[model samples]
Target: MEVKKKLLDIVRDTVRFKHYSLSTERTYIHWIKHYIFFHNKKHPKEMGKEEIEEYLTSLAIKNKVASSTQNQAFSALLFLYKEVLGVDMSEWNIQALRAQERKRIPVVLTKDEVKLVIENLKGIYNLITMLMYGCGLRMNEVINLRVKDIDLGFDKVYVWDSKSLKDRVIPLPLKLKQRIAVQLEAVSELHAKDIKDGFGAVYLPYALEKKYKNAQFETKWQYLFPAANISTDPRTKIKRRHHILANTLGRNIKVAAQKANLNKRVTSHIFRHSYATHLLQAGIDLRSIQELLGHKSVETTMIYTHVISEMNKAKLISPLDF
Candidate 1:
């Protein structure tokens, strides 16, 4: 089989398994292509554990890629071998690459700095940032939020299909309820316009479009942060509503940070870090904070303990001992 034909067949088989996102599909294909090129156009079937080890070592030693990048390549190759090519790699003993110990702390903002950043943002961007800090939401989660996912009556935001395909409910800050209400009103107007223009389709996950058919067009399924105009779906080539672009929010965040005179580097995820740290400072239990941030493990939530310890060290002690 020709290499190009085999690559296409492998991609099709992977997609047929379902549940994979377009981003994952694209990444997997790109890495697989790179792997083939690295071996001087040798077919992956002709290569074995030795070739795989060398490719991974090249990624670490020569290319100097991060551990995560190498891991992504490993996963892609594993899928190609085990699933696409129907080969068992379980008995394979490939040499492992040593990953460096990264000790970089996440960038966090002080309470005043968080307030300053939000205050500098105007309109929709302001509301989005407030939710990021208030609910500790990831940038993608905030952008992918749908109308029905928010339960203002219960004061919780349903994070559906999150990072790990897990769903969790996080508290909606009472302080931002009114702001959310105003944003919802704007969303309602946009929803009405989309319906009138016959472009109300929402972007469904993997195979849901085939299952529900018109569920994408339902108002309840509309994006909370809808794009200003209709655009063609890159996969289906159908005109539909998509969420706000990440770059748009990214640019606004940079401008807002500058206007607030915050010298520290700030990004949308900084609000999430500040949210977790602020809760820790307020004496919230680690377990409770874990649930609020929708972290799967308490270990993931433990990073905030370091921030709290640093803050406590700065406190002035009295000269007189008890």
Candidate 2:
């Protein structure tokens, strides 16, 4: 009989089987590696609850990781034991280190500030920034958009397999539609060029490539924001174009923020934050905004109410006036 494969191999297989994102697979594998190394490279099968507790404690006390990060590591380990190892850890009572109460608020930009930042950004970055802020889309959601996802006829963007594993249609900003149309034309030309060069293939998720034999060559499935050049797909070693790096897009936002003379910490996700807060200020219904943001619960969307309340000066009476 053939011997069983290694633990990480099994973890990869399990993650793929469950359709977990590539980022999740990397995170799970990273935490699992750290757990094994912390215990002198002993196999996790040799470890138990007490050992797991020790590792999580080390993360909080020694590593000084945030509460959310610590929780992620804990979840990774739990998944490893339960799913990969088939270990029954139902009685496991590992308590994670709790984060201190933080009264953190989302950083929002005034209309003028948003305009200034957009002015500072140029070309593709400008369009990307506009999409996120205008459509209230998260970074991953915008970057993962395909050519077919943008419905110019209906003036809506179709978001598939979003964070909540649900599909949503968000209104397209009329102002940006013309620029996006030009972008589509450019992409069409590029697709034609790629096909002439004998490499028009694009990737699909969840084994869709195997399901549809010639879908990869179809323009509809192409990435709306394709990379500058073709690169090898790490899993299959096939050379194809992928989407622009999200990190690069984020860095461009930071540079533009600085150029705009904004003092607050403006990130790519800040665009989404501002979107929700600004809509609340406009008196849009909370439930409607919740659906647009693709949030599973209205409670998540209600945080924008707090932001708008803080920004609204009408409710406040200053002691200095007295």
Candidate 3:
């Protein structure tokens, strides 16, 4: 038990040293622990590609996990072997029975539907949704926004260290400029209160806190959408204000969708999809949309073309209608 405990501790340290988010660190730890337990608590150094394959194949066949979930599990074990254990996984050539990946178009809300959903959402959630649809932000990207990321003078919104490290900038939506200013004022007031209470530090990414000793305590470094209360940081154990939970944003969006009486499935990502699709429909060039959406490849952005094509075809009159 002590050996397993120490192994996880080392994994956590490695993940932190690499500057991975807390959510990612937790996920990696969970999968690594599960892998060890699956093999009857055998240390990962004792196992190789064969044991890894057995565990992944079982996820597909026994647990019936999705391809992405299985892939995440695979990545965790790969990190454990290569990073933590100093083993060369390049030659492993894992051939596990892979879970099937589905090719489905993203569910996008219509412009009017977006307005309805926004109307149903209250306070910060409303502004967050607008930013997601306006800037094609992922849930994490918007929720993890820092005060320094928004530039009202330049009318820009900067997204940093997003999924796959795709950092990009977006034009600030003219409609939401006032709302953002109001939000900034609220954050400033809250930050002052926290400092008065002797707790004003915010979580800085990676080694930034070390480099800039006072950056974590600065108002610009604070979360743009902070949580209602200061809490203990799980990693550093520092009492600080953190950003709003992603699950809270997602849950509120779901509730707003239900209240809006929209039939199609709604998720935080739906707004991003809508943002991309609406840009395409507005005759925005594929390359420009790709850049705005911070897609690493044009091919990933091409999915919006299919969505628009399908939408157009759905508009065609059937024989009965004719």
Candidate 4:
């Protein structure tokens, strides 16, 4: 028990040293704990590729986990061996029975449906939806937007450290420019109030806190979508305002969808999917869309092509028409 606790402590310290997100750190820890416990609390140092494979296969066969979930566990184990335990996992062949992958199409809304849902949302939620559809932003990207990220003069929105881990620039929608400007003004005001109350410091990613010294207290670095009230930072125990929770954004989207009476399922990511499909339907090339969406590969962006093809199928005439 003491050994496992000490190992997790090392893992936590290493993850923080590497500047991984809090959520990612937690996920890695969760999977690592599951792996250790599944093998009768055997220390990961005593295990190898075969044990890893067995555990992953159990996730597929017994737990019925999703393919992504299985991959997540694999990554955590890989990190445990390579980063924490300091073992060479490269030579060991791991042959795990993977969870079945389903190739279902992403759910997308029509442009009109997007409008309908947006109409039902108010204030920040409305703007969030616009950015997701207009800029093809992931929910995290939208929530993580800092004041400095918006280039109002240049009509650009800069997405930094997104899921792809690649920073990219997206064109700001002309219609939402004023809305975003208003949002910035609101954020600045809220930040000023927080500072006057002696708590304006926002969380900085990675070593930026060490590098910038005062960047955490800067208005430009503050989250554009600040929480309504100040909260305690779980990691630092600092009383600071964080960005709006993903759950808050997701819940609002659901409520808006219910109000809109739209038949299609709606989520924050559905807007992103709609954005890609809409761009494709407008004859934008896949490469341009790939860059705009910050996709690492054009193949990832190519999913929109399948969506387009499926939509076009509805327009095809039956054999009787020929």
Model 4, position 282: C-alpha lDDT score: 89
lDDT of 4: 0.92
Clashing pairs in 4: none
Q: What TM-score should be assigned to candidate 3?
A: 0.96
**What would the TM-scores of all predictions be?**
0.91, 0.94, 0.96, 0.96
Off by over 4 Å in 4: 1-5, 317-322
> Mind giving the per-residue lDDT tens digits that candidate 3 earns over 26-131?
9999999999999999988889989999999999999999999999999999899888999988888999999999878888889999999999999899999998
For each candidate, the alpha-carbon lDDT, in order, equals 0.85, 0.89, 0.93, 0.92
Model 2 pairs whose backbones collide: none
TM-score head-to-head 2 vs 3, winner: 3
Candidate structures ordered by TM-score, highest first: 4, 3, 2, 1
Q: What is the C-alpha RMSD of each candidate to the true structure, in Å?
A: 3.2, 1.9, 1.9, 2.0
CA RMSD (A), model 1: 3.2
Compose the digit string of candidate 1's lDDT tens values, residues 1-322.
Answer: 6445666566756765766766788888888889999999998989989999999989998888888888899888988888788889989977867455466567799999998988899988988888888899999999989888888899989998788667889888899888787778788888788889877778887778789997887777888888888899776698987989988998999999999998999998999999999888888999998888878899988988987777777685777843
The reply for model 1, stretches above 4 Å from the true place, is 1-9, 315-322
Q: Write one digit per residue (lDDT tens) for candidate 2, span 112-187.
A: 8889899999989999999999999999999989999999999999999998997999999999999989888888
For model 1, name the residue pairs that clash.
Answer: 202-216
